[model samples]
Target: MLSAQHINKSFSGVQVLHDVHFSLLAGEVHALLGENGAGKSTLLKTLFGMYRPDSGTLSVAGTPVVLGSPKDAQAQGIAMIHQELALIPELSVAQNVLLGNEGRELLNYGRMQARVRPFLEQVGLNVHPATPVKRLTIAQQQMVEIARAVARQARIIIMDEPTSSLTTHEIGQLYRVVRDLTARGVGIIYVSHHFDEIEELADRVTVLRDGRYIGTVRQRDVTQDQLVTMMVGRELVAQTAPPERTPGAVRLDVRGLSSNVFREVSLQVRAGEVVTLAGLIGAGRTEVLRAIYGADPSTGGEVRLEGVLMSRRTPADMMGRGVGFIAEDRRHQGIVPDARVSVNMMLTSWAKGKVGVGERDMLRAVEPQIQQLGIRPANPHQIIRRLSGGNQQKVILGRWLSAGCDLLLIDEPTRGIDVASKADIYALIDDLARSGVAVLMVSSELPEVLRLSDRILVMREGRLAGELARADASEERILALATGVHTHAKDPAVA
Candidate 1:
């Protein structure tokens, strides 16, 4: 249905794509595989008319086409769902689905609901059409986006990280939707970080690295290890976290925590201890973190730091009390995407009055840490957004290090990062622990939690279900607790 030949594109002085050739046929689900910053997004944007390639020839359905704008792409029956969702917060689900194509003389609430209810049901979404998009979960919002594409009768759809925030159950639903779309001969180009999902859904896979096509392979003919090798061009190493540090007295304590999203949660982390919260999506791990950090209001709870009671627990209050948080959605909540590295690194230090520190001074301060943490390029003034996803995460870690946080709460530290960078981050966290800092981590990767945490706490239905010490924590133990599987097993330390 779509083909491109000899595509060339560039950003500023950097050439991102060169002589790239690609094609997608009707009824085929093509998997676009690459490490972050391999120009996958750029290539998708080129196909969707968001960027005009410096040089390329494009065709759809055997006709030469010049996609000048998003409308042009849509006119040709192509649609894209971005990595970051693009739903309006104030709009209802039905309105957001029908946006730009609502053809009515007057707004008909009932009519709109009737028109969209079937489509919503087709995607297995139980959400009411009149509910505001802001109130929906990330997975629900993605479903709405897919429904909108179906409403538009798009023949070719491109989805970027659609399952990043989805639970395993939601992913099964989405896979069904993809199957339904393909059964009707709609072509799909899927971009994702989860290789297992790609293996389950794709027929053919194309690999890209460093802005060039490496090769394409049939899904059935290649192993996961082979694909990783193609994408990275090197052996991927999973480094063991450093030696565990002896934990000191309790540095952070939360008792009887009650929030709208979570309730009756109690936990604590001592100095130098790394406690990981493990659970599936919607298990309320992020809500508990926010409540403890004072970013979200809790109806009933008490936070104590080293026997000192805290009267107020706002973000400012937490920061003053030496608590730092690195949120999960780094793009939306963590960093200033457009700012220079030095600027982002200096943000938490703003209260200390360093307005964009000089390159020499910033480097002088962060240079050794950057090297130790393996931050690529080691430049403090480079625009942060231009860096790869892993490097951006490292930059965020550098921020906390530069600011000297006493207790750190990190959420999904390696969600989409590369393996090498993941090792670096693990080492950085261990180094922090050695310095007498407490680390509370939240992750969806069971093996990661098992490997790095001194103890693992599993959440089920928004409550702490079980806790396992490092020596006793295993994949089976964590998974059983997370999925509510009953087994004759116990973490002796917790018992």
Candidate 2:
């Protein structure tokens, strides 16, 4: 349906895209595969008219066209659903969906909901049309984005990391939506790090590395290893389970932790150990982390660090105690979009009264962590917001490292990250555990839980359902516990 040839884009004397080529066929889902900073986002923005390529030729249905702005692209039936959500928090779902489409007209709230409801249902989003966008979960907001695209009736749709935050069931729903759209002759550009997703949804896969087109192949014609090699230009080392180790003194202790979303829950993490919280979306796993980090209020609970009860537990108090939290909603809660990388990485340390350090000293200290984490652009002065999702996540990890956190609470650590970056993050987490940092993580990906966890704790609804040792855990067992099909006996360590 759409094609671009020899696309070259540059920003501020730095060339990002070099002779990139892409094409999409009517009724076909084309997958774009690339690591962070591989120019995938840049290419997508060019296609969507958010950026005009420095040199290229774009054609729609065999006719040459120049799209100057997003509105121009939308007029040409193109729509982009970004990984970072763009919905206004205070606006209702229907209002957000119909925002630009609704022309200068008279009042019609009832009509707006009626017009948007079908699109919502088509995308399997069940929330009321009048519900505020802020009330929806990340996954639901993603579906709303898809629904908005459908509402736009765009023949060419671009989805960036659409399933990053979705549950397994939600992913199935999205697959159905994609199939339906394709059945109607809509062309889609699917961007993801997941091989399984590409295998299921894509017809042709294109690989890009460092802003250059690597190659394109049929999905069924290429193995995952081959694709990895194409994207990173090397034999990607697989992440294996860490070597067995004995944990040391307990670093964190939560007893009778109660919140609006979760019941009394108790867990403990020892030094040099990784404990992962495994459960489906809305299983109260995130709530537990927030309560522990003091980001959200806990009605009844007590948190202790090294046998000392923490009477006043606020985010600042936790930071002072060498506790670090990596929030799941990175775009909203984790990053300072306007700040430079050095500033964002030093936020925790500064918050803990480390501001006495000179600016040059702080930048010097942050430089090593930046390199250690492989944060792209590798410049401490680069604006944190300009980096890709994976790189931004690395910066967050660097922040905790700079603060010298002994206890880390990480939620969905690799969400929206590419496979190569995921391996890097896994290695970093393993290194942290080996260095005697206690790590408690929440992950929706079962493979990640099995790969990293020394112990797995499952939550269902609002309570702890079961726990399993690393050797005893599997996707089936985790699902069983998460869905209440079966519950393992409580581990004495956690009890």
Across 366-466, the per-residue lDDT of candidate 1 in tens digits comes to 66666765665466666777767777898889887887788999999988775556666787888898899999999998767866899898998888888
Best by TM-score: 2
- RMSD of every candidate to native, in Å, equals 2.8, 2.7
The backbone clash count of each candidate, in order, is 0, 0
lDDT of 2 by residue, 1-495 (tens): 899999999765667899999999999999999999898998999999999999989998888899899998998889999987889989999888877987532168888888888899888889999999999988788888888888888999999998887877778988999999999999999999989999999999999998999999999999999999999999987778879867999999999999989998999999999999998888999999998988899999899998989878998888888899999988889999988888899888787776446788787789888888888878787777777889999999988887788899999999888989999999999999999999999999888999899999999999998888988787878888888665364534233
- Per-model TM-score, in order, reads 0.90, 0.94
Which residue pairs show collisions in model 1?
none
Candidate-wise lDDT, in order? 0.84, 0.89
Give model 2's TM-score versus the native structure: 0.94
